[model samples]
Target: MEIKEHYSLKEHHTFKIPVQARYFAEARTADEILELSRHPAFRSQEKLVLGSGSNVFFTKNFEGLVIKIAIPGIEITKRQDGYAIIRAGAGVNWQELVDWSLQQNFAGLENLSMIPGTVGASPIQNIGAYGIELKDVCEGLEAMDLESGEIREFTAEECRFGYRNSIFKNELRGRYAILAVSLKVSDLSAPGVTYRPTASYGDLKTKLEAMDPKTLSPRLVSETVSEIRRTKLPNSTLLGNAGSFFKNPVLAEERAKQLIKEHPQVPWFKDSQGIKISAGWLIEQCGWKGKRVGNTGCYEKQALVIVNYGAATAKEILAFAYNVQSSVRETFGIELAPEVNII
Candidate 1:
């Protein structure tokens, strides 16, 4: 592994934020990662594990080593009860895995069609979109302990997934490097179209009825998901963004009921703790959509997406996000937490 000094991170991250890493190394295999952990330069310094760098905001130059995970491979193995297990290397692009599953007629990841980032980062947030989450299909993951360089496998339960949270982002934060993830997917067809975009566009029951159980096509689901996401989210090539900036805040039932009394049209979904309020709706209610500050602004199409119009600095983008958060909180008495990890 060739470690470079003063690496530009502008192009590495999807936000296109101009920032520098003091030291950088690309690890293509598990052994390479272990070796890097032993390096004196990395041993005593704060280390950042980088995947595709899609879900992060770099406010300033990093003072430590940024280890980019570059390991790549995918294997499909047989599992019990007509299911198949998919093991993907951490460096594998997330969308490519979705496409591969479609090509192979595997049926679990269709709803996550256009999400950016790498396989290694998916479980860190237990990423979800449409109607499915990574945890819904996750079987296990192989991760190396950053301190000892010893590899350990964690089951789904061990991950402790919640909305935009996992053990990797909390208890085990910065302590483990995810090397590969194993997911169990069905060979036999099953369709999940309960989410808004899917339900509005596809006739789920009708499509399922038409497909022969013995020879169902995964592409049917994948294509439907792709079409919906393409229409919903801005193309990253055209506009730099890391999808939604904030998580939809879940309010206590009593708080939601109080809000309902104030604003009868407020939309919500029941969760284990209470009701999850839509962040987009909250922002739009606060009148921040299409609001621009310098070159950074909220997307005209998606209230939740903060965009870099041309040359917005990381600081400017974050300032804009803070303004949105402040406005939403003042209006609704709800605090919006960022989904994008601000580094």
Candidate 2:
């Protein structure tokens, strides 16, 4: 792996934020990652492991070593009891793995299809959509402790997954580099395969049924979800963006009840911790949807997405987001938290 200095980061991230890294390198295997730990700068320089840069917003140039995990491969290491354990490299594209799983008739990841970033980043964010979350299918993962150069395996339970959160984001943040993730998926071709495709969340049922597929299968769900997303979200290639800038605020049951009573039009879903209210609906109600302010603004199609019209600095993005937050906090007595990692 070649390490470069003062590297331009414009192409690495979907946001297209014009930023540079003081030091940058890509690791294609676990050995390379351990090699990175032995580098002279490893112990002295601030370090960060980056994936596809799909879920981060660089507010400024990073004055640290940025190690990009590029480990690759996807294979089923175990199959039994009508199920199989598929292990994927952290560097593998998330959608590619999803498509592969579908092609092999492995069921589980269809709902998470089209999500940006790499497999290495999945467990970090506990990525989910429609209904199923990564925690639901993840069997385990192997990560190298960047500090010690020792590899450790983490079970799904040990990952401590919450809504869009995991232990990787909390107790273990920045300490380990994910090398590979293993997921258990139902073998649809096996006799008496009982895995049922989920298409009941949000408008999924409506759209899936509209397609009129004879069998509501993983392939159909993947395509339907992708189609729905394409219509609601702008392509990052044309417009710079990290999808869903803010998370749907999870409100307590009583607070949710009161809010629902007061604002009957706001959409919501139940969460294990609380009631997840639509951040997009709230932002739209605040009149920020499609309202471009300087270089950044909420996307016209979905208020949850903040887009860069042409040139947008990280400071400008933050300013616009802060304004939106102020409006929401003042109007609804709730604080808006950003989902994107601001750095």
Q: Best by TM-score, which number? A: 2
Best of the candidates, lDDT: 2
Report the lDDT tens digits of candidate 2 across residue range 1-343. 8999999999999899899999999999999888888888667788889999989999999999999999999999999889999999999999999999999998999999899989999999899999889999999999999888999999999999998899998899899999999999999989999658787688787887676566678888898889888899889999999999998899999999999999999999998999999999999999999999888989999999999886999999999999999999999998888888888
lDDT of 1: 0.85
In the range 138-217, model 1's lDDT, one tens digit per residue, is 99999999999999999999999888899999989989999999998876543432211233223343454565654445
RMSD of 2: 1.1
Each candidate: RMSD: 3.8, 1.1
Superposed by TM-score, candidate 1 places the C-alpha of residue 21 at a distance from the truth, in angstroms, of 0.7
Model 1, poorest ten-residue lDDT window?
193-202
| Residue 131 lDDT in candidate 1 | 54
Clashes by residue pair, model 2: none
Count clashing residue pairs per candidate.
Answer: 0, 0
